[model samples]
Target: AQSVTQPDIHITVSEGASLELRCNYSYGATPYLFWYVQSPGQGLQLLLKYFSGDTLVQGIKGFEAEFKRSQSSFNLRKPSVHWSDAAEYFCAVGAFNQAGTALIFGKGTTLSVSS
Candidate 1:
């Protein structure tokens, strides 16, 4: 079975400050990892993904993540956060099945940004 855990339920950041969110996963084999952002009442948008190769992957909105095989971790990082960056972030892992592939998500981490 595959599962993901996001330790932080919520985080608050000041504008122009850096931010980081933690994530850990349990999987039998290498998993497809992804980070998604969702605004209030909005659908999720892909921030980044780690399908294969390159431990470090970059995505839109100036977000980046490093896939650490040893730690089984893929943490999101931003050098500086903006007020508009306030949103809910979810860490997900993709699993393959007979039907197809599906994403299993974490509880999510809400980010509050203040100016």
Candidate 2:
């Protein structure tokens, strides 16, 4: 079984401040990692993913993450956050099986950005 956990339920940051959101996963084999952002009353948009190769992956909106195999963590980070960046962030893990494959999402962390 594969699972993902996002420790932060909510986070508040001022505009232009650095941000970091924690994520952890449990999987039998190497899992595909992904981060998505969802605005209120909107669907999720992919932020980034880690399939293979580089441990550090970059994404849209100036976001990036590092895959740590030992820690079983893939934490999201941004040097500076904007007010527009306020949204709910989800950490997900993708699993492959004969039946099918799907993403297992975390509870999500709501980000509140203030000016």
Cα lDDT computed for each candidate against the true fold? 0.96, 0.96
TM-score of 2: 0.96
Candidate 2 lDDT over residue span 7-74, tens digit each: 99999999999999999999989999999999999999999999989999999999999999999999
**What overall lDDT, based on C-alpha atoms, would model 2 receive against the true structure?**
0.96
Q: Which TM-score value belongs to model 1? A: 0.96
lDDT per residue for candidate 1 within 1-115, as digits (tens), equals 8999999999999999999999999998889999999999999999999988999999999999999999999999999999999999999999765458789999999999988
Q: After superposition, how far is residue 16 of candidate 2 from its true place, in Å?
A: 0.6
Off by more than 4 A, model 1: 97-99
Give residue 12's lDDT in candidate 1 (0 to 100). Answer: 98
Clashing pairs in 1: none
Minimal lDDT window, size 10, model 1: 94-103
Candidate 2 lDDT score at position 46: 99
**What's the residue-level lDDT of 70 in candidate 2?**
99
